[model samples]
Target: MRHLMASAALAALVAGTAAAETPKDQLIVAFNMNNVLTMDPAAITGGEAVQILNNVYDALLQFDDEGRNLEPRLAEAWEIAPDNMSVTFHLRPDMEFASGNPVTAEDVAWSFKRTLTLNLAQASGLKSRGYSAENADEMFVAADPQTFVLNLPEPGDPKMILMYLTQAGIGSILDSKLVMEHDDGGDMGQGWLTNNSAGSGAFSLQQWRSNEYVLMTRNDEFWGEAPAMKRVLMRHLPESQSQRLGLEQGDLDVGLSLAASDLKALEADDDITVKTETSAGFYYLAASAADEKYANPKVREALRYLIDYKGINAAIMPYFGVERQRVVNSKAFGALSDPGYALDVDKAKALLAEAGYPDGFDTSIRVISTQEFLDSATAIQGTLAQAGINAEIITGDGGQIYGAMRAREFELLVGRGGGGQQPHPDSNLRALVYNPDNAQEAGLTNYQGWRTSFFDPELNGLIEEALVEPDQAKQTEMYETIQQMIDEKVIPIQPFSERVVTAAFQDNVQGLMVDPWTTRFEGVTKGE
Candidate 1:
């Protein structure tokens, strides 16, 4: 009965048919929500979770529509200390949560501390910048009822810390009192938060069924601009064909997970608009340096020349990514917008011969069974074959593929990585290049550099130096030097393309943010 009603309402929303529970003012969006494992801010990962949480939870800061600049959210104003050791944020006065509890500085402090105390997925952003549970009290403090102060635990970039906080769900400030009331045996409300919400954003979670759908209702107690949509129904329509059908039949207001072909077809629809934006991360080819064949720098350099970046971007990466050779994304502050490497079978074969592999060795490429990944791997396999390298493609689910990479067991893999969420160079460099410990038991699987066994003390030192550099001009120069160093050293990871996200929405909807990191449904509205 509920499903029938939802379908009827969605159809009526655009068809002007009989009304149901879903009002015309409500929004119906379809997207693949398979990655939304939990509602707990600290435990949630991926852009889908962040997209939902952005409306349900208000973070200290938020990214602008472009996902480049930071704007005020819960924090009205923020300032970094001259010493770059601390950042203070001034909260707006007279704020209240959905329960009418006065939003206080203690709540903000507790929320930040909770992430570290739980040490969940979201805590890594803070942990990478020297924050820990031991120093939680000193690092995250409430100076007053309307002020929150974040003190750096070590020499690091305060700007990066602010950028980390700008990620909606991860850095969300929770209502401590409400969460504590649901705490189960010092679990810090993890179990309860997995199903419930304790936030002060423009919307509140009404219902969520795993891999089914999520329903959010507007929060009347919201202190900021009132939301336009009374309700938002995010249906778990994973299949692109279903989304296309729904959109074509006037049943879906937005289809976020449509295929490139479907999106191209929808571009011809007069009532639909397709939007695309360059998102964080890179789709690259990585080789495990621990393998004897890939251990030599000459082999790594040959691997770089073997990738047909232009061909891959033009063919398989139409709606997925664009050709980008640099590790740092183009939107970042210190990013270099130049294509450094191209396809050259001759160069690759010469380098391979120099590396003592004139006959070319056999290698296995692990890739996810998804369409884009498998296709990209196949293209690379064809190119590698031309250079006399026999490449075998191994396909599996994300867990089977990335888990092998995390265990440092893969020889070669076509994958997407390089955490570029913070819009800073260190965000990508720290994940893709910096490797402090090369020992087998180091167990630093979180760092891709360690996973691929690419360790350079000088590169690590340079990244560290660049992070703490105060002068903007000198810091940018340092980043340029690091990029050159990466090329000269023939880093294991060769970024062929930068990720780009595409979505199709009804033309009637206004103020829609296409990028998941900055997407907020609050300002979205349906036209009459």
Candidate 2:
């Protein structure tokens, strides 16, 4: 406590002294630096990277601030084949990159093909949807300088295809000329793009320091309306207390990832505005299907009842997230109402007994060391103990914990997954539940279905069926049925919260978006 006070005092002194040098047209944001793993859209992961890249890159389509409504961006309009197997994007003419290079269809094609060739974080999304690297060039054709065509070899909805492209990684367009000029070795400029940006958005990457800060300068040659801020600074402050202090002392213009307590406190402060918007992700507890301990459907169902959803949402997830049982976000189509099942330890014990573990069994729970996740896990642990279940908490960073889950090495994991990358129900369904083949040779390890080793041929068929269904009402009906099946069968994963990214910024800082997907420094201005 004493050390914190001293640090706070020093920060106040520094902030006061630095105020004179800082420009009113510049914004300084402090958030957890650890959230951004990479800037290269092809390799980017997590919301932090998505939020940063949204400002630095432009996509064919984007979600507007209020509605997750899809709107044309780089592409002025599009044409979808009657068969729904192909879609062509008509690029806006006279588009210019930060480097003043004219945006072309070839650049957009290369940007997408680059994602497939590199096979980084984004390849799986397209690959699963049926675009292969071997045929990428053929899949993406630059019909002309202002026209790009995307041909889907698989049987999937072109609407979903367009929706997937709305995300920062898969949907982002790049400047082919600028990126190729910096290509080192055969990495397709992966090394260069890791620190630099070759995009046509409102800003350009000025500098980035891992676990430190990233600075961006306005792009004078930007194709659209310029941002109010001349520069934006994002500092990596992992500790909530530090971020709160920074926001309070005017050392930071915006503070991200503050704890619930701090957010409540900030809500009372007249100088700060605490905004919470629904994020594209969820908090879930997954169990490996390969483990016999959870093999029985009854066991998985019991685990669901064991979770104290109300207690956790009220005590732990407030401001950060809210109770969300279904895998699909409430904001998506075909979303079901919450089952409204409260915690019942007796019911959980009975289910466990039916699964042949009346006394319950010892298990391990893996969770990231973040406050919300850790607290939720701890609360669940105590609840499980009440049902005679002994759960050992294994905590680590996101990579360490999620890596274990991805490798199919975890028994149980409490972590965040299921990005509603697109507003379509298929978007969330394909990610959290769809599994085609579970064989080791398939190498579909990136999917949450594979990570949890959860596979059901019937469920798989249902997902594919729903995707191809064209009738709006029919499509949603099939999706609702699929969701019902998942709930009844006790799928290996249970979601407790639909995460909402919260940030406290200066009351004077206007136009700061609370949604990570739509977040950008554009139009942001400070008061006098």
User: Highest TM-score: which candidate?
Assistant: 1
**Runs of candidate 2 exceeding 4 Å displacement:** 1-17, 20-22, 35-39, 183-195, 209-211, 291-293, 353-362, 396-411, 438-444
- The Cα local distance difference test for each model comes to 0.88, 0.85
Q: Each prediction's TM-score against the native? A: 0.93, 0.88
RMSD of each: 3.1, 5.4
lDDT (tens digit, per residue) of candidate 2 on 1-528 = 997884564344334424532357778887776858778999998778887888899998887776457788899999888887788989998999998899999999999999999999889888877788999988999999999999988888887888778878888889988998888888888998989999999999877889988878899988888789887888888888988887787777888778888989999999889998887768888899989988888888888988999889988998888988989888888889988777998899999999899988999999999888999999989988998889999999988998898778999899887868677888788889988888767767667898888899999999989999877799999989998999887788899999888889888888888777778788798886
Candidate 1, residue 479: lDDT: 98
Each candidate's number of clashing pairs is: 0, 0
**Who wins the lDDT comparison?**
1
Alpha-carbon shift of residue 386 in model 2 (angstroms): 3.4
